[model samples]
Target chain A: MEKIPSSEITPESVYLSRRRFVGSLGALAASALLPSGLRAADRFEELRKELTPLKSITSYNNFYEFSTQKEAVAGLSQGFRTSPWTVKVSGHVRNPATLDIDDLRKKFPQEERIYRLRCVEGWSMVIPWMGFPLASLLKIVEPTEKAKFVRFETLLDTKQMPGQGASWYSWPYVEGLRLDEAMNDLAILATGLYGNPLPPQNGAPIRLVVPWKYGFKSIKSIVKIELVGSMPISLWMRAAPNEYGFYANVNPAVDHPRWSQSSERRIGEFFRRKTLPFNGYSEQVAHLYAGMDLRRNY
Target chain B: MVWLKRAGLPILAHAGALTPLALLIWNFFHDQLTANPIQYITFRTGKTALVLLVLALACTPLNVLFGLKQAVALRKPFGLYAFLYAALHFVTFVGLDYQFDPELLKEAIFKKRYALVGFAAFLALLPLAVTSTRGWMRRLGKNWKRLHRLVYLAALLAVVHFVWLVKSDVREPLAYGAGVIVLLALRLKSVRRASAKLREKLVGKQGECRQVAVHEDLR
Candidate 1:
């Protein structure tokens, strides 16, 4: 496993203290100190992208579990319960167990990773996600050699997620990645955002964050993680096979049948910027698809 | 009641037609249009175009099925409104969204299938809009009706463009598709003939009234 740089890891106490200091400064003073566009954390300066405002990140989302309308999801997700959540890790594993959210948090040390989220819908956002690498959790479960793919499932409570009642998509949205991709150092099971618990609309409790793939592959509000021999079918692929494929890597060369993928609009910006292949994580993730044709897979 | 029918109804229709654009402008000023204001504006304008197009198509059928002669007068205004919204939708995409980048716009029109369909629909509406005036109607004479029939094709293409553009949850587009189909079905020759026959049977000796109604509407 690749080691995270010690300089990048801010102690939890320091993080809390900084938040208090920033909050005490209030909105007007903070705006005076930092320019509007330079809102991202100092640690993420290496990425050269601004963090999408927390308002935009929480408000404008594609969690179809709440509603198809991007603006409606945040409001509709207000009733959802994240605490007392338990995640079931099973299938093709030596030690399959149902772990409580608290247990999962205590067992692994969390790290804040700033990653660019490129949506399949031609929009992008940089998010400061706080979570541990998914590999640590998979190690605890002890996946057997037969585990070729890792499948994820979201919560299915229709009362909480009203869009599940509609036939737009099948219930309990499912997503999957190859076992190797799941085990990658960049892959994270995010628990929080902006140093706070994950917002309900942004997939509260826990969510997957595979930065290289389009945002949908990072399925939200996860309840199940399973390892299987054969490739697992995902919801988007089942809904529209031609438009959304299994790999769903952010590729500028390959366009979605309906829209262009060559460029994407950053959330707060008026103009679009050229999209990056594998969402600019090409060095880390491009090797995974070597020898295979991405266009065919897409 | 007579004044209301003669003048008030058309005024109401015009106001109704402009409400979406007005509401969008209001939302823009208030900062209530969501995170991506451009997307909100584009979608609202596109939806307004489709809705007005459907309403314009419905005008002829309103007179055919019912004896609403005043509804035929609404066709021109609604058709023009539809064209205005479609033009706005196109301008927003090419100007605001693409920022007049010819290469990007060209790629969108040529390479993207949905864009091609949507642009085709807009192009089909253009000439009809230009010739909508009374002078052009008089100059074209018999050819005017033939030219106006192109609205049906434009409506079909517009609905298909919407259906193709959506990622999933196509219920909204499907409903619009159903509306277009229903309007087209109502205008079919066989359906018109059956309706005429039914009108003739109902009015027996006063059948000239039905012919006059058909001439004014089906034209």
Candidate 2:
């Protein structure tokens, strides 16, 4: 599944290219990451070695109703809408694209990368997400200088999503990141998890996965990608400004007004443990915020 | 000592019976329970409170139906349990759910209908608890009986609160509501019967006095 990289690729072709790239690179990365002793698809098992535990299970949720508990998302999201899905890439892009789900899957070469997911509520989860770097997808969109940030929009219909109908939370979630953050190598366009297609609750079809930021920053069930010169509005931050901030980085020192961010409860941890800063990935992302005060930013 | 035998031991026993509750709390703090333990804690406390409340209400019937002289002992403990769980329920909703934001609390009460009913129910429970102590009961005397009557009101409000708190698929709340209605109806019927008998005695005494006065004037 060799993807022909081109400058003027059609949205349809770009979509197809992404899926091919994902499937191929995923295999390639597996072989690269694993020792030769392991066989084909055997690398997923090695990748599973890095299939780490979350810093906190409570925060690692998609808010899907199937499971009343946090760990229930895996079981509940099995029925997530995957096929016939489409992501419309519009607003400030050089070329407006309406990419079909099948084509997008074929276009991207998947790679399994382990990352930590820190929630705004002082909890964290670590997962081995399967997809290519978001940089690859952004490369196809080719944002102009005016594209200061990338905004993501989730599907909002309450008829399909019962959570939206209830007062549990607001629906049609929106999340965004600065252009630089969106293009970071850590940023991922996830299509699958734990060596399978993405669960419906985990932003099935295609979703942005920003590891360095809070879990909400990685929106699920994306239907629109907007590149804007202006700072795009974020839903959670707007909902409660003091509790939620625009830059939801994982910093143990900066406590939320309600709870201490210094510690978290891992899902299977017999004892709740003190939280690690940057969810134990400080080596990767601490440099990005080296000079800035996370407390103020938080 | 006599009062202790009558009232204080039951209260002490009720308070001591919180051992399981203490264990649950210990389980949560020690991390023996699941993460996001607040939801579990909240639900467990609520269910326990509900059961105790039903038991508290049933004490009167037990005194009448089964002739259990010690049924009064259950009232204080069960009432206190209901109060404890109600407090926990509110704490979970405010602490875990809203993160102690007064603004969010205000918004929920103002914008959300369920929140409004829930808040009202919480307020109703406050007076009933404050008037629960024997000291307060003694201090108020007759006023105490009038104030403690708030329990019935509080019970009605709680049922309403639960019923409205559920948006749809309300079979559970409806059952609770029906139970509350029947219990309250029994009390209402008994009160009406007593008042009717008292009115008849007063009227008959007045009629005899009038007849005697006429007989004296004719003689």
Candidate 3:
């Protein structure tokens, strides 16, 4: 693995030379470079402006599998076992295999991706995630032409996750993305954050990070990844179809029936800032829904 | 002892009602209000307001059912506390969250259904809070009861506001809805009549006990 000085990296340079950076740095240095206190955005100028504190990113979360209260999730999720895990990749893929978590780490080299996570509840956070691109994983699985959507599922154990016992939502939380969206470079299968293993409350072992959509769309603690011909029903969408749509892309123009999506309070800020279209990734993901009506879909 | 019972209990209730606010202040000063303090404060105050509103609504029913005269004395203080929290909740949204941006605040109230419902709930409680004093109560006379009845509507609107505000999970709001429904059901004419009958039976027993005590004292 090549060692590039952190001072040399800028947001523009990082974005322009992502593949080169990922290829050179490889697996060895990704974890070594990310000290817990170091802001992932410190080396990148654009991201530095809004990066949320590591404490907030780990502590303030909406992993309903633990609890609803943001502060309570950390303590409640302490019992979760993340190691000795395996993720099954099957369904409409040409290669169907259950790969151990350790094998996955060695298979794909880690890349550092800084992303803004916007919650549907009107708060946002900027996090530095360490992971490999979803496209890389999909390529390994060799998704067949019949696969229209990529479905993801979180582990379901009432003993491990106490919230699973509640009938408020269907257990074994699931999420999905269109095959095109899944193959997008922006979508990542993250393993760690702030240079360390994922804290249990923030989804441990492995998770998906879709930057352009609401935070809930980035399902956590993924146990299964299935390529399906039909669109998979997501946990939130199934529970409240009206509130949580399948393509929960962050669009300020498309207000939720109950609340305004026009602005969001940045986790550390006092006042709300105007929300951007596609969470400021409009140039990349907006074309995905070109002719489709966002308001109707939302 | 009589003075303490009459005055001290209400004072204690007032302190109890302010505990949420006190905790919020302490948390704010200690930097423990979490990352999104504005959102935290907004939710905290809104929840406290709703809880106090429900507690205030329960007071009249308690008086009607078991004839707890002390519960009647608590109604004004609880309602006022609810109003105080509701006002704080609104102020947090307008002053802190919106930073007093008129355009944003207008859009929130006019365009957002949850904010509109929340604003309406607060407005409904405003007149009731203002008329809580003995002077206004006497001046309004018969109209005061009719006006104060708006609390039920306010409570319903507040619950709706909460239910709509949540992105997906409705369990918390639904629980509040059930509580409000049960409280509202107790106010029905038939339920009131049944409660009156039960109240008479209990009051009759109390009267018999008082009479026996008087006879023993005379002997």
Candidate 4:
């Protein structure tokens, strides 16, 4: 109610289908023929990289909020209601408020960015997401000097999400990034992917995308964003601290206690590929962890 | 018709045993093996192996609780299929998942407790699978039965492997563990006698239910 970003129109037209993503490849090629379109196509250099087939991308998801079984999530989440959403930004902010989901895109124009998403389970996917920078949103809320970290929370509606009743995991999934890490340009709060508004299984309406970290770091169906002074204990960290660390940067050298992190199978490929440090975003974000020991932090 | 009755259960067992593998192949071909094919294959094979192992363990209990002495005959085939699936699970991990990279394999076998226990379970089944033939049974005599008891160890290890790998939401694995524990509990002499007493009354005239559990060519 405090930091309202003006009024909102109904959410933009969302083409929530696999065809748009599958068709984008051809569209990119044809658009190259036009001078103006070529610049736009070239802007998304990462798009040319092998996009995980839209079918696999949608069907194979790790939204445990819907189901633990990856394939079942798509089917189980088919009836999830995502419209008429609000995100409350509070804690350690000068102007704490709840903003309409549509106003986010209206305030910060959405951009198309293709990123590689790696899961802690040692599987990977390359996805094209439509969203704006978290830094822009963070600036709007205006964090105070006491704020050292940003904690994100997913919605906790048991009637809507069946997996929420999975008592072993403390519900209302939570994840956090350091103040500096939250401000990084690579972090984006995504609303949609592959020219379509996100399907329920892929976290419809809104989600976070921190490309460098494990997929769990990108909490989905977010309802709350709170800035705090101390490092927040994530669900995984609280569940198995020995395995899942707060700074879960994709470090191949540090193996998960349960499985090998040294290599990962790209979803579509037959063979496993060597995992990159910081998921190949080391060049851009490595300096943030410059002096810290990653192995211990991991 | 008499031959059909004699052969019916074996035929049914064969169909039931091979179906999971066939479905796995069908799914693999149809692009229904989910996003992570290797993982899908791994879980399918591992689950099939564990389930079949439990089924094989169930055969004796079936005979013990009922007068169907023929149930003991299924123990061998079910166990052999369990071994087959366990081997496939191992190959999927070592070959497809890791591409037989020795360094990674070494690291995993040492670092991951689940891998180590799973490998031990496979090793436990190896001797039972090998000595399953009549030739080896004739060769070892009483020793053969002693060696074959390692299957109980294999079943226990496989369940532990499952429990460890699944970090949380352990209801599935724990259920399997409880099953193995109950089956193993059925092996106790006192429990077996009590069950046999109950079975004798239930089975009435078919009093061939004397021996609660006997290793009949159990490989």
- Tens digits of per-residue lDDT for model 1, B25-137: 89989988888888878899999999999999999988887767788899999999999999999999888888988877878888888899999999999999999999999
lDDT of 4 by residue, A219-282 (tens): 9989999999999999999888888999999999998877789988898898888999999878
By DockQ, the best candidate is: 4
Query: Please, what are the lDDT tens digits per residue for candidate 4 over residues B1-219?
Result: 999998999899989999999999999889899988999899999999999999999998787655477788898999999999999999999999999999889988899889999999999999999999999989999998899899999999999999998978889999999999999998787887686666667666455335423423322
Descending-lDDT candidate ranking: 1, 4, 3, 2
User: What alpha-carbon RMSD in Å does predicted model 4 have with respect to the real structure?
Assistant: 9.4
The true-versus-predicted C-alpha distance at residue A193 of model 1, in Å, is 1.2
* lDDT of the candidates, in the order given: 0.88, 0.66, 0.85, 0.87
Task: Write down the TM-score for model 4.
Answer: 0.89
Question: Which portions of model 2 show Cα errors greater than 4 Å?
Answer: A1-60, A64-78, A166-170, B1-39, B46-74, B83-219
Clashes by residue pair, model 4 = none
DockQ of 3: 0.54
Residue-by-residue lDDT tens digits, candidate 1, A86-110: 9999999999999999998889888
Q: In model 3, how large is the Cα lDDT of residue A278?
A: 89
- What TM-score does chain A of model 4 get? 0.85
lDDT of 1 at A12: 100
TM-scores for all predictions: 0.89, 0.57, 0.86, 0.89
User: Measured against the native two-chain assembly using Cα atoms, what DockQ does each of the candidate structures obtain, in the order listed?
Assistant: 0.70, 0.07, 0.54, 0.71
Listed for each candidate, the true contacts retained, as a fraction, are: 0.73, 0.07, 0.73, 0.90
